[model samples]
Target: MKKFWLLIVFVSILFSCSDNNTSNKNPYIPSYSVNLSIDMNLPAYSNLKFVSNGIIIPNYGAKGVIIFNAGSGYTAFDAACPNQALTSCTAMTINGINAVCSCDKTEYSLFTGLGGKEYPLKQYRVEVIGTVIHVYN
Candidate 1:
């Protein structure tokens, strides 16, 4: 009858909407883990830019590029922005002491690794051993 068809249509619409909502949800958490002693040497990092291969290390939290500077005896951060998840632009560009997410122009402080009035970038733990740099979750 007409009522039965209407009920089926309503159910179908409900399920479709639910599916769309679930698909749009951001379920990714960026993290990574790298052995500093073996992967990166601290002395070599000084005053130079060291970039990691696009490796998704789970302990670090999400997919991102790790940039290290040895000149200032400092390391920078670019925790992939969760806001720009679906695109190929997963890496953040470093502008002096800031990490800029190119997708939406979200800027994060490289010194603090905190987002500016936007979404916060997940920071990984950094450990230095002698001349080695280690990045982890």
Candidate 2:
């Protein structure tokens, strides 16, 4: 009886576990390998030291990568507009804490990666080591 109960418990616990991995990838943007490190102390990246500020690093991801300082931590997203295909105007330009797409004037928030359209901005992983910010996918 004891052995049967143990087996039942083991089976129940095993069945309870699940893979909860979620991805914020948009279908329009191509997945690119990203492993960039930005030093906040550097003159070029100094603006990132303040909260709610972001910068676009060209020639990195689909169009590029936009790194944002989201107060509590940092976030990085693909510069390509999530709502549309890759075109000359697909690359978004930053407007304060938001990234605006010229194609349809769709606006996306840098802090949350949410946009007005169906697809949200594809997000990358971010890590901060002291003053240096590391972005990867």
Candidate 3:
């Protein structure tokens, strides 16, 4: 009877265990360390001052980095589309607070990073110091 109870306990423990394995993952893209800063006072970056607006900085990351000024604060994300193939056209362009991928027209919200795509947009870190905005990964 003791062995039977031990076996039952072992079976119960086994049944209670849960597996956390998840196969739904984003595309495999190499992570590159990003460190960039922009002056919001500049004419080119002045558009970032308003909510639901963003600007793309060239020559950074796989494609570039999109900086957005959300209503709460600011956010930065990789310009590369997370759902599509990595190509020049896979880069995202700013349309209000949404980042639109030119390849498949996948639009991701700049504020929440969610959209109709399979995954959310790849995001970076944002730090604001006066008129200067620093974006990094």
For this target, which candidate reaches the highest TM-score against the unseen true structure? Answer: 2
In what order do the candidates fall by TM-score, top score first? 2, 3, 1
Ten consecutive residues with minimal summed lDDT in candidate 3?
15-24
Candidate 2: worst-modelled 10 consecutive residues by lDDT = 12-21
Pairs of colliding residues, candidate 3: none
In candidate 1, what are the lDDT values of residues 1-137, reduced to their tens digit? Answer: 99965664554334323323221133444334433332443343343434222222222335454444423333334356645663556666666656677677877645344465444555444555665556643
Each candidate's clash count:
15, 0, 0
What tens-digit string does per-residue lDDT give for candidate 2 at 38-116?
A: 9999999999999778999998889899998776667788888888888756579999879999798888877667776
Evaluated against the true structure, the overall lDDT of model 3 is: 0.72
Q: Which stretches of candidate 2 lie over 4 Å from their true place?
A: 1-23
RMSD of each: 18.3, 11.8, 14.3
Give the top-scoring candidate (lDDT): 2
Write down the lDDT that model 2 would get: 0.78
Cα-based lDDT for every prediction: 0.46, 0.78, 0.72
- Tens digit of per-residue lDDT, candidate 3, span 1-137: 99965664453333223131121234634577789989989999988888668888977877888887765567777788877777547578888768898888878877656677577677776778999999876
Pick by lDDT: 1 or 2, better one: 2
Candidate 3 wrongly placed segments (more than 4 Å): 1-25
